[model samples]
Target: MSLEIRIAASTDAEAACNVLRRSIRECCELDHKNDPAILDAWLGNKTPQMVANWFSSPTNFSLVAVSEGVVVGVALLTGAGKLALCYLLPEARGQGAGKALLARMEEQACSWGVKALQLHSTATGKDFFAQRGYTDAGMVRSPYGVETVFYWKQLDEDTTCPNAPKRKRFCNCNSD
Candidate 1:
């Protein structure tokens, strides 16, 4: 897959949501199971309209991973140093898309002088974040009863992973 990472636009919301839905429903199934209610509640904010709002919001920034012209993954970062979301479709995982998306998000964060990054992760995703240097801050239950684990990483000059490649695949949409 030829992957490119770029800043998301309101127009990309539908495709981004597609990736988010698949990621949450399949890739993170271990966290939500087949419980319809849980899936419904957990995925409520993953709609295209909501994603579009993220694109338009001054407090949020989003990135999309496109492979061969399709949006296969997404990562969202907040102005307050939160990694609001980072998700990839199953087929997009294990092929460097996640790392690229995250690296760019971290780069953007550090560019803004953000000193820390934090996120809530599923049990399935906790290790992935940990491997990239996020320290676990323990777990918390969501208002909807999902047990989500919290992870935090103090940012510095060397916070980025050595394994992350130089971003040579940025799309023109990257400019704000």
Candidate 2:
């Protein structure tokens, strides 16, 4: 199914939270695994109420992908040019929704004069970001103890860094 991407509304908070929670539980095993602590910490802040708060943030811009009026994906960008969140339901994976979501969010950020963009890529998303031109900024230990890579890209210039150590494991989510 194709997705229509658009700026998210406060009304979309609930559905967006659903997509975020499900994607984390069903699609992020490679990164969070069966660790209850990690999962809890990662999932804790993504409740619908928190999503609404995200929408209310003046410096945070968000987008949602809808298919037949149901939200299936979400991407959030902060005023600091951080790609704060990017997720899609497992079924929506590989349908180009992920790419479209990121592209639209990136376009919006660029239009806002964002010169650079950065995100912390879980082991599950390093290659996905790498393939889309993000550079490795090294490993960061999350509060949950997950060691993930920080990725950054210069939107105003062509700068690439591909020679970082490969993640020890791969994710099914990134496969075709």
Candidate 3:
């Protein structure tokens, strides 16, 4: 079935948190490298309650990607224009879920009058954000102590997507 993107409800907290945790553990092998300390620090605050609070916060917008009735991805955009969280399950990768999540977040940001969006990207996500017009700003250490790439993207007032060659299929890839 196709993926469906929508605002995350309180009940989805557990599933969403699972996605976030699993995404970091599996997809971010390059960043954490199976280091116990790093993984613990990174996932310390990712409890279901925290996820629910984040999703319900007035200053934040949270979304989930549902596939076959399962939550497979999650993203959170802050009022201050930060793309705070964007993650997808290993099985959901290369299925257009990430692209759809990002596009939705950008749209929500523009609607909220946010002129730009800033985010810290993992090594695995660097190329993905770059291809979406995010400029490499610099480097920063994540709260968990992982070196991350800082990226910023200025939003067009009109918020229209630019044209690109059609891909043969959806594959969560920067290029097709």
Candidate 4:
């Protein structure tokens, strides 16, 4: 099935939260099968307020993936080029939605003049990001207390605005 990607609206908060929660559970099941405590920490304490704050942040840009009119994936960008969240429903796994969402978020970051993108990935997602050109920076403790692997990707410089001054260009050319 073809997935549609678009900027998430306020109405999408609930569905996005559901997708995130399910993704966490699925990741734990697949990658941390022997660690129940870790799984609990990863999926246990999410609240609507946190979800709302994530979507409402001025620095955040969230995209939702829809298939058959249902939200199946979500990706959020923050801290300029930082990938704050990326999740897909279990049923949507292995589909192109996750990659598409990540690509779109990278595009968004580039448009905003960000030179690099960073993210802390779960064990399940670490390999996925690595396959997409992100290099491991180090391991960090996620808010959930699970050790997440941090990754970074340097973006290509924006040459389209070569004649324009660096400060005025859409994407930072310095990071290239």
Local accuracy of candidate 4 as per-residue lDDT tens digits, 14-69: 88889988888765565556477776776665555677777788889989999999
Candidate 1 C-alpha error for residue 74, in Å = 0.5
Q: Score residue 142 of candidate 3 by CA lDDT.
A: 92
Q: TM-score per candidate, in order?
A: 0.88, 0.86, 0.89, 0.82
Q: Which parts of model 3 have CA positions greater than 4 angstroms off?
A: 159-176
TM-score of 1: 0.88
Q: Is candidate 1 or candidate 4 better by TM-score?
A: 1
The most accurate candidate by lDDT is: 3
Every candidate's lDDT: 0.87, 0.85, 0.92, 0.82
Poorest 10 consecutive residues of model 2 by lDDT? Answer: 157-166
lDDT of 3 by residue, 1-176 (tens): 58899999999999999999999999999999999999999999999999999999999999999999999999999999999999999999989999999999988887777778999999989999999999999999998989999999998764432332223656886774
Question: Residue 17 deviation, candidate 2, in Å?
Answer: 0.7
**Candidate 1 clashing pairs, residues 3+ apart or interchain:** none
After best superposition, candidate 3 residue 35: deviation in angstroms? Answer: 0.8
Superposed Cα deviation of residue 170, candidate 3 (Å) = 43
**TM-score comparison, 1 vs 3, better candidate:** 3
Runs in model 4 with CA error above 4 Å? Answer: 30-40, 158-176
